[model samples]
Target: MSIMSGFCQISPAGLCVYSNEQTSSITGYSSEEMLGMGWVKAIHPEDRHRVVAKWKKCNANRDTLGTSFRLLRKDGEVVWVIGQIAPFLAEDHRVLGYIATLSDVTGRKKAEKALQLSAERFSKAFNASPSMMAIYRLADDRFVDANNSLLEAAGYSRAEFVGRTVTDLPFWVEEKTRNSITGLLQGKEAVHNLEGRFLTKTGEVRIGLVSAEVIELNSEPCMFVAINDITEQKRAEAAIEVERRRLFTVLHNLPANIALVEQDYSVRFANNYFCESFGESSGKYCYEALYGRKTPCEACRIDKIFQERVSCKWEQVHNGRPYQLYGYPIHDIDGTPLALTMSIDISELKQLKEEMLRLDRLNLIGEMAAGIGHEIRNPMTTVRGFLQFLGAKKACAGYKDFFDLMIEELDRANAIITEYLSLAKNKNIELKEQNLNFIVKSLFPIIQADAMLADKYVALVLGDIPALPLDEKEIRQLILNLARNGLEAMVPGGTLTIRTYNDADKVVLEVQDKGQGIAPDALKKLGTPFFTTKDKGTGLGLAVCYSIATRHKAKIEVKTDSGGSIFVVQFQRKSPVAPQMN
Candidate 1:
């Protein structure tokens, strides 16, 4: 048999041959033709001696032995073979030729070679991958698998991370971190992309987003985690938090008051100023804080607020200080009412208001003086010329005395015109600090005469008022205007009630009238120019009342209905430019 069969058979001494299907498989030959071939011919020329020696070992022990040897196929291609040989025994147990079997093994060998090449490629890719990747043992959380990227990020060697559970050297984490990882493992939540801190080997901490998944490795569960450094995001978040705190400080430390309220009537939140304004009364109800009484205030402003759902303004005295309370209602995150309220100390504001009203009055007086001067000056001039002409005429003797008397009257009329001019340009007002008590007390005698004019149905009721700094002339004017308006408003007459009191900061004056009510539309215009509702009304009565109240830094409030109207003036003692001296 030729070795070209790739599995020729022969004995150790080259005796009769015996072979099997393995020889046909390797050489691609028919088994019947190969069964008689010498085994030596199956060996390649270079491997014949090695093959003979390996078979000799098998022959001596009469047992099968396996070995690798090269052979030639019938197509003359060299292929690898794994052959097993055993010595065949005679029926009487004498010596016999060697029996053997072979496998092509070439396909298997080539497959192994390809597998080795693929493994090398995968190892290279794993080392070069950008994402920090690691493999951990599922049972113990030991680092079993890792790419070079993970080593660079962790600043640790393969040995440093390998045996250590996340507990050991902690190349990328600490003990607490390890516990968190253990919890994740137990819960099997497969936590991912969680930014956390890690301590390096040199004790420097690094921030990273660690993403991981649990999987089975070599039949045991393990975690494959990928970590991405994101220290910048952490820094950004910290900066934003700092900025937020600064803004909050600006609002909370304001000089005035600021408060945060819910849509409900309850007080939900407040700032430092708010806390100071309300004192310990914060966290109570909004209405209850201002009034110590049981129910909400009768003059509560929220009723108007409910109609418009917008910012609202009101005046109230809190802790002896008058405040202009402004409330703004906004929407919270869930699109619900987030109410904010602020109280600005308006004691100075009162004085500003008074100054404005006084200026308005002077302006009106100037107009009236101009109009009156134009109307009366021409008439008086005619009277003066006629009187002069009459004196020169002897035939007009009877008219002389009449003309003379008219001229004298004209002089008096001209003098009155001059006074009206002064009233028109009325800037020079004497501001004297006077007593409200004395002023009201002085008006007691005239109350009877005013009532007599209104058929005596109107009664004047006086009460003691705080004697504070005021302009006595203006105070008197203020009372006369109120008394006069009350009588006029009630044709049938009504009671006139004037009362006064004082807190630590301000003096309060009230004038209530039980007469025809002032319409709501005409309320704001009361203190303004040309605002009145009466026949032959100059609209200057209440405007004058406004002027008097304003010179004293007072605010006028009018409440009216079918029943009557109450006009109240609140005066503050302190001012910005100069305090009023009584």
Candidate 2:
């Protein structure tokens, strides 16, 4: 036999008869010590009984046997050996003895054990990982294994995905993504942080960062993919972007000057209006940008905001323009404090408030004038009657002319008082349903006569309109007053237009004059008592017109251009009846 193989001959009773030099070399035993020892004694103590029973069975049957067992070496080391035993025969076909050959296989067994341990460790790590992980066969993209995280993320059970291919599962949001991944894998590319979209079992698309590499699993080429779901992170980023755009739009389009300032009074951000007005004054003091001062203003509200953590407001004037300033404290996501300031132009509002005060004063004066007129009319009537009685007496012939003149002056004074009394606050109004066009037509003759006296023309353009609740006498007075005013404002050949029309839900009575427009100053005071442009006029005409319009719940609007002026009185188509006089 070859010297490399350990050869031994045993009696049919399973005792060792002879042993080769290779036996001592393989088992670390001397030839003298192993010659008479039973072959079972060379077997490892843990495997001796099983080998002895198998050897006895083979001897009795006179059959050949092949098996592997461990041997206890003389050095106390265990060695794996593969053994083949056979029964030797004589020429007469009778069994002689058993011969066996043994080969060492310790290194191969150790290598197999190491591979099994490595596979177990890999399985534990893959399943215990937090990331979604899966192993798919590269040949057909079939899922071979998946971790618990992967199953949960995909909203699928292990049974649903273990035997399915990528195409069988609704994993990819777009088919193109699958094709791209396949091509990259085929090219032996390592996918690192590749962003892709995936679909869950519930048909939800999730954004994921995927990493994959080609690996050998169970001796077959496969892909090991790791996915990190970033769907929530991506959505949060998108919403933040939208909010940023919205904030920028609001800041850019705001009519007021808005700015963000730091605690040091340095401007951090400024809107477009602020930048345009302050000449790109970021990083400068607020007073320096707004008032051209070197230091902060005495009215700085930023200090108050930082101290109280609340909003503050004040008014200031810059370059003769009024401004209302406001300040607020804001905190960032990290709790860093910031100051927001806004300045709005209030110059027009200021002027309007002053104008309202003046109007209020005028209304008070008008009320006083009405009360005084009521007292003066009674004595004036008695004085005018006595003057008429004295002028008719024969005994006062010398002073007859003086008496007549006094009575005439008294009557003129009474007429002026009557016009003033018309502006009283508590005038009784009797509102009833009346045709506006019919009212205009009834007053047309008077309007025409007034226009003819001034060598002007009167045109009545009446339209079919709905009946409105109005006091008939007051409406006639308003038409006559407006028509006469129009006629007086026109030139000799100019036209005075009286037009009645239905506009929207109201009836409009328009009186237009083809004369030079009123002066801006006089136009503003049109309804003030005793305010008029005519030399001999008491401004009570337009004032009375406005008062009557107020009592009837109508609006009076005047439009004047360089060519002419138009006064429009719009009355509601349906209005409640006004209270009658007691």
Candidate 3:
């Protein structure tokens, strides 16, 4: 019989008596060769003995036999087969030959072997992985298995972890996180990078990124989870953020304009002062936002920083105030070019430097004037008396006009000498308790007469001030010199204002002129002896004013702009001294 299965009849002695075509094809042997041959000979050696014993017993007992074994073919190949045999007995109940049917099952056996090999490989890889991994049975929500990484992370042994549910362990620090993960898994949706807090057995918390998916294990659905610990990374980020805030606070409060500009001329960052000065310029073009220009400024300082890729320092003027700017080429972590700029107001510093230079010049002149002033004045007074005597004599009446001009020149020379002597550091002065406002009020009439002669107006404003030690004559001279200078500097109809007030612990006298401001170059030389801006000026007028101010232990400060100028004299307040009783 040639059906789906091979058919063969065996003799009572377990020998093959007859075989069908399918039997010959399955065994790789012909029917003639199999006749009277022991069928046990075709069974593989590994199963031949067991199969022969079972076949003999089944034939003797007149019962059916069922078995599966590897059969050897004629070509030396082995095939897996399953067979069912039934005894065909005679009416006398004696022993009879057996009829057997065999079917090929090699394909099923090979598939089962491949599947076992794959499972073995997967188990080895899962246990050896470095990332924490675990499997939980879906039916009971219990851990079926956990890798070594997961055990070390959770502070548990495999024996203690297996068969334990999520509730039985202190794993997820928050219950909601655990519930969320469970819900996702139950819905058969994958959880990808679900960040959460995890707790170890020692109660230490750790940040982790968890991912999970449903997988089949042991013919049942289970959840496979992977966790990546990121506790250190998170802590480092927080520390960096705190440090950034501290640095920002320091820059914000600094008394300078600080900014970071990108290569595109856009403002990346600006400190509080810079923002207040420029009006919130973040993300805006530096030139347009800061300077209010439609185009980039010519010879821009920050531009040079990027072009040269170096640091630079320069002075610039903004809103009539001078600032010293420092710019540096900088790059970020990504290597993007930028410019870091800081601008500090240097207006007061420049003024102080100029003042020091002027003082140095004054000291040098004072030393020279003290040595020569008295010598020059003695000769000039003697010459002035001789000239006056000659002008009155009849013999020299014809030369009277010449003598009068000579005497007048001699007097002018003597006056200049007196002004020079006042510059001497050891010049004697009489200090008395006198009110500065009273002194200013007393001098206003003379000042007004001079302003009227120059076709200018004069105004006086006096505030309440306590009396202080002052040299009355020196104060009068100081007031006259400053007032005359102010009157000369203005045009017709220009007003001159004189003001006196108490400023802090000092007294302030301000002389203001409504005239074109002094030039910057000349401003630095204002109090230097022999430095003058007027054509008719002997240049000793302001020098004498400065000398008188120095003698009184006062400070002179000048403020000027395009509109006008103000000369301020600050006098230190002093206590009155007790008079000696005769």
Q: Pick the candidate with the highest lDDT.
A: 3
TM for candidate 2 is: 0.56
TM-score each candidate. Answer: 0.56, 0.56, 0.76
- Provide backbone clash counts, one per model: 15, 0, 0
lDDT of each: 0.69, 0.84, 0.86
lDDT of 1 by residue, 1-582 (tens): 344333445565664354455567677667676655566775799988988787677667776778888887777888888776666678975556555556667887889889889778867876788877788886776788688877877788888777778656556555655566668868868777776787766777888877777876557888877777766667776787688567668878888777656545566656687677666555677777655656666655654554578888888786656888787876543455656777788877765675566566756776787777778798778869978897769988878888788788788768656544543444345765666767777886786577776675534444444456676766777787787787677755466777777755667677777787988667646665556688866566676676566556677777788888888778885544677799
Ranking by TM-score: 3, 1, 2
The lDDT ranking, best first, is 3, 2, 1
Rate residue 337 of model 1 by lDDT: 69
lDDT, candidate 2, 520-543, per-residue tens:
888767777788888888877888
Error of 1 at 339 (Å): 15
Model 3 Cα lDDT, one tens digit per residue, 1-108: 438688999877878888888888888999998898887788899998888788769766777889999999999999989888888888997767778888888898
Q: Which 10 residues in a row give candidate 2 its minimum summed lDDT?
A: 354-363
Residue 404 lDDT in candidate 1:
80
By TM-score, the better pick of 2 and 3 is 3
lDDT of 2: 0.84
On the 0 to 100 scale, the lDDT of residue 216 in model 2 is: 92
All predictions: root-mean-square deviation over Cα?
A: 10.6, 11.9, 5.8
Q: What would the TM-score be for candidate 1 when compared with the true structure?
A: 0.56
